[model samples]
Target chain A: MCAELIFYSVVPSEEPGERAEIETFLLRNGLSYDEGIEIFVVGREGRKLVACGGLEQNIVKCVATDPLYRGEHLSLTIVDKVIHLAYERGHSHLFLYTRPNNIAFFAGCGFYPIVEVPGLVTLLENSPIGIRRYCDGLSKSRQPGARIGAAVLNANPFTRGHRYLIEKAAESCDWLHVFVVAEDASLFPYCDRFQLMKSGIEGIARVTLHPGSQYMISRATFSCYFFKEKNVAGDCFTAVDLLVFRQWIAPALGITHRFVGTEPFCRTTGKYNEDMKYWLQADLSAAKPVTVVEIPRIESHDRAISASEVRRLLGTNDFDRIAELVPQTTYDLLSSKYRMKAVGSHTSATA
Target chain B: MKIIKDAMAGTLESSDVLVKVSPSDGPLEVVVKSEVERQFGEQIRRVVADTLARLTINEGVVIVEDKGALDCTIRARLQAAVLRGGAVEGLDWSILQ
Candidate 1:
């Protein structure tokens, strides 16, 4: 039966019918087609789509095998093909999101469980000790303090509001660990955002700037953070991200508090802020709960200073207005780097 | 032979083993996940270590996912992965035995 099965790849954009076929196959298997998936490897036993798997960046999703083909091990063929595809694309470290019940199946394929949000979702990585290795590396930078504070920020261009949040968080705790979100999905790339953050938060005592990892607010942990649409499953991804932070990240550094700036403009961000409190503090069953601290957003002319507003100003080439919203370092970098490009194109600043 | 890049070989089918080799800054680390780990875990590790020793590869991460594959299959997969990983500067056809 296995020898008779044929496998093929499908690019969703190129083959809409085949993509819909895979999506329908996934739906029948209790899985939905993720919009983020780029390529899918489907196993067919004489025109019957018996098994299917997808690769979205480095993460594998929407893997399913027909119930009739249970003993044929068709899932392995799909996974093997998907993994080869990922390696060809230079993605060595791979992740998979599966149901809790399917952990053993993926584990058999050499993917170990990283984090699980109960029955909602389970994240698995190719390496068994990947999360352990990340946490171990983090332990080397572990600071000595009783009241260790932490904050995760994208800091797209590092506004004054971000500076204020860091300063306030640092003042409240003995030491502060500020992780700049490393995903390059924002208007500003990660290096620029990281540099802007480094310069913006300079001269602040007892503050350590750390680069974000997949265990942090990354695409693997929370895809919704990068997307504009409000997904119902966003809450689930948020929980998984927060859980990874609480279970592995905070424990590695002995962090006691998590800080964030108040979000008044974006409803999604504001809801995330509300969810943080529930996940980080109220829902702790055994581990020590990290206190969620929300500082009011810094205002400029009665308007809350946000990276989005700075971006909007940059689109319009309003350096004067952007200068008011962002710090000196951010303003300098933005104006110097984007001044020429902003003249002809404003689409890049739209985020 | 040094693993200069990431490479993979073999499949996840029955009686087969999938091997992935990547350059590592740390020491040579071989991770084996097999269905028969309890019975052949140590033997699998020994085969992987011996294979790396034969290739004179001292620094890399070798991951082997076995689906009831024989020792010869594991060796073949690891060799293919190492060769594909661009550790072919010094040809050692004799050591492949």
Candidate 2:
């Protein structure tokens, strides 16, 4: 049977029960509330809210989804509903108080911050409009102690440069959980991107692919957060994937190490690297904190090759340069779909 | 790796390379022999001239034995050779002052 998705506004009779559930869920999820607010739940089947979110008209604090049902972009859906409702009800601006990690997810859904109060994350759970039920169903769906090594790759379609990084990390780990960015928010769709990474690294054993649904829905680390003006210079906002991995995935599934490419290509990545280093050193007391391995950038024509440069050249229809910069298969795949767009077309907006 | 051993030790054959620099003419060049020119002669000349044009050479001549160097490598070796030759005292001081 097709999964039926439903959306509804909360009535006065359900306030006390929903508020209690919200408090319990917030406490269980380590959230807090500071002001009276409103709450809503969106679910696929009756009496089961797959996602929950609400806003405080006075303070603009809202929490959308629990740790479960995270990768489905359910949080974005919930956030979208709340933003629309808030606007329709005569509020020109809406604010969401979120954990620093989930900040990107909210930003992707078009919410911005006016101020950041450290130690205010708990305020979200304690607020009047938070989730009430503290169900462990989401936590139970994930297998504990499942060692997953995650790589937040921009795999501009994998090249030898990318393969080298993956191979290095795979050698040391049992299951390499390669997270593919699924947001169609990229130049290539998630399917094509996954295929390229898989085909490029076909020989590697014990590697599995997970959809970086969190990343696709994230706006904080990319253009979205910047557009929203929620970022701070030294604050170094974390990606939703990294935040989810730390909060929900790492503790729930047991991620031992995180693989990342060297910061030769991106400033966004440089900031991510710094934030991850700080977290690994600080709060990871259960399992050993996450370790980062900088994948070596390959050299060609005695110059270091990068995805950005390749994309730039591709915009000029320079397949020959791409072949030299990337692997043969990557060159072929990129050229077939992207080559036409090269001749005077702009680079992918996501890039 | 081809060997370069011939009767004229300093003179550049069609295959031999003479690398030098002078401040007045930046990385200037004059091939002693032109018979053995290869496929990308014009391109190679342009590459060399274009690369040298960026330098502040007053006067100098450079000769090269390009078996098959891409534009990038040729430029690298040319730049290296000019720097090396620039260090020599009184050999050809006209261009690299």
Candidate 3:
């Protein structure tokens, strides 16, 4: 017999009760909300959310259905809505992660299996021109020895600390792939940030700049840094994102080491890097084996030179103080004819 | 005002209300179904009835299936539905009302 179901999209910021319902259901089912991503849920007339999913960029994640609502075809129903929503938003490609046992279920929903980790996680895509395009772009300029290093940087305005991390990583690896966070949610637009990254690494002979694809700047990772109040997204949040990168992106590019700058003040980032440390060490997959290298932040005037501090100084119109924290390239951008109008939405004092 | 065609506005999603109006000659029939009926049923009915009264709509069958929408969302959606139902042109969506 078929059961009637109620389905709807929710703006968590607008509807607290419905958001709580979905959150409680997800927690009971052993899933966490990837903050900053859009979420949709199916509920009963009484307002108890039973099935739910989130969309971050082109990925559909955190999909969960309450046990009581099983056999109702709720998973596919939620997936279909998200797929239509993605198409409406102009996303031609979509990806999702689920336990290894459910590969056939998603394949039936038109997803092609990409990678299956030994333990329980699997990645699948719904596009015909699937992951090969991404793999080819990742290894665009392959170098020898296979000891490639990877770093995902927003580099809102690349600082000396950023330069130090890349240079430190370059010292040990044959090639370094620096992925600038391409999510337009950043204070500095992607183009300006990409320009700053290029200029920051211009002198490094080994560093190559690439946009961290849709999978990188996930709501699962760094996008929701300041939205922790909406949900308590601990290390597991970043771990999910890093696991996807490790299982899907790193191996194809021959990247053996992932470099990150240590966070001293931001609790969210500090916990995120810590989670990356745990996952990389505990992940025993032959194809997913990776070493996470967290470099000590470069210090200036007894303080860590950081993008957040530069943003703070920019907001206060303290160009001289900002000049000291950033590299010559960023300083040039700040002072040039364009006269970088300070636009960061986030800031933290340097410690 | 009289409803002319079978019309609907708003999504079936939670926190929204879908109002379907069908043309009817029988005494104006209003049927209300709501998720939050225990606490907000009377309020929901009042909003729908008040909107119909403002439109002078007394000759149609109106069905409101509500899912805990706020007063304003219900108001906006019902207004949109009434305008769409009449097959008329003067949809005064100005918030003054």
Candidate 4:
């Protein structure tokens, strides 16, 4: 017997009842509902929710179909509707996180596997040649050297500590490729942060600056919601991210060493550094392991200089303090942009 | 006609095809994924080429995901996608012949 299905788009923030129903449905299917999901497309056979799919930004997550309606193609319908919704919202590219066993199912939906963290989760993208195209682009900037090194940095405002790390890394290797995190989730916008890094490293001879892509430290690849254990989430996130770097990205650029700064603050970043060693250097069987080099963070006023310190000073309009933390280029830009706001607020306070 | 923006048409339902077109700096590139590719892969490519030729779409990346779609379904979906991708000028209906 064929079962007729109906689909409905539910925004969890707006539809509380439907959100609860979807949460229960996902749990019943052995999938946890990610709180970060922006929207969900649920398929119902009359009053019973039989299938569901979600979109968290450009990543599709928590897709499940009832065992009773396995061959009904309800999963495809839910995914199709979710894709349409994402496209309408200006998301041309999409990613999916699924278990290894379900790779064939999602592949049938046009998603090609990008990377897999064995027995944990697998990352897939809608475009079959997405990573290939990205690697091809990276190949254009490939440099030939035996001790080629790489570093990925957020560089929110290009602090002095960041310059110290890059300079130290560049001095050790024949060539150093520095990638500024492309996601604009920080206080400083991506373009401005990239410009600050470029200006700060103007005369660094052997270092090349490149923009990061979705394959690198991006929201789509760094999500920790797929793991059931909260403790392992951080490790899985680091493994997935560094695996993409070690597999597709490092080989494309001929990088043999990965450099990072000693994290004196932020426990998450510190753990990520520890996991980076295991994922990139310790795993001997996966791919050619890349050496990990950790440089001590440069200190200012007896404390480790950090971008968070600069941002905090920027909040209080303490230009003098911020000046000591960041490079001259970043300090100048911050003063020029925030000085005007500081004056405006001062005038209003007096009035 | 040129693809000025990214556009998509059709659905992933059974016996249907989903066509996605996006602007590209390179030459015309077409990628087709079908369940029956071993049996009718060349036929599907020919239909896509013929449809793009009719629409005068000589550039952009065209991706088609097929699930046992007929030849005519592929053609119609490609035309709709090309049009939606900003190939509106000089769209002579006679090309349908």
Best by lDDT: 4
In terms of TM-score, which candidate is stronger, 3 or 4?
4
Q: How much lDDT does candidate 4 score?
A: 0.84
TM-score of chain A of 1: 0.93
Would you give me the overall lDDT of model 2? 0.51
lDDT tens readout by residue for model 2, A1-351: 746767665532368676666556655554553234554444434555555565545124435455666663566566545554554454422344455566544434433332232432311211111111111222333433445576766665566777877787778776676766654545666787778887887888776665554222233222222122234324424433344455445544456788776665467666667666665445633435776665666678876666667767777778777887777778778867777765543233222
Off by over 4 Å in 3: A1-69, A72-74, A97-101, A112-124, A220-235, A281-283, A335-351, B1-97
lDDT of 2 at A111: 39
Q: Please give the distance, in angstroms, between residue A98's alpha carbon in candidate 4 and its true position after superposition.
A: 0.4
Q: Tell how far residue A122 is off in model 1, in angstroms.
A: 1.1
> Native contacts retained per candidate?
0.75, 0.00, 0.00, 0.62
Model 4, residue A45: C-alpha shift (Å)? 1.9
Proportion of native contacts present in model 1: 0.75
Question: What tens digits encode model 3's per-residue C-alpha lDDT throughout A154-216?
Answer: 887789889889999998899888888776766677788899888888788788888766667
What TM-score goes with each of the models?
0.92, 0.47, 0.62, 0.93
How displaced is residue A307 in candidate 1, in Å?
0.4
In terms of DockQ, which candidate is strongest?
4
Candidate with more favorable, higher lDDT: 3 or 4: 4
Question: Which residue segments of model 2 deviate by more than 4 Å?
Answer: A1-148, A215-217, A220-233, A239-241, A284-288, A343-351, B1-97
Q: Is the docking of candidate 3 incorrect, acceptable, medium or high quality?
A: incorrect
For model 4, chain A alone compared with the true chain A gives a TM-score of 0.93
lDDT for each candidate structure? 0.83, 0.51, 0.70, 0.84
Q: What digit string (tens of lDDT, one per residue) describes model 1 on residues A260-339?
A: 88887777677778888888887654557889998998788999888877777887899888878888888888888987
**Lowest summed lDDT window (length 10), candidate 4 chain A:** A342-351
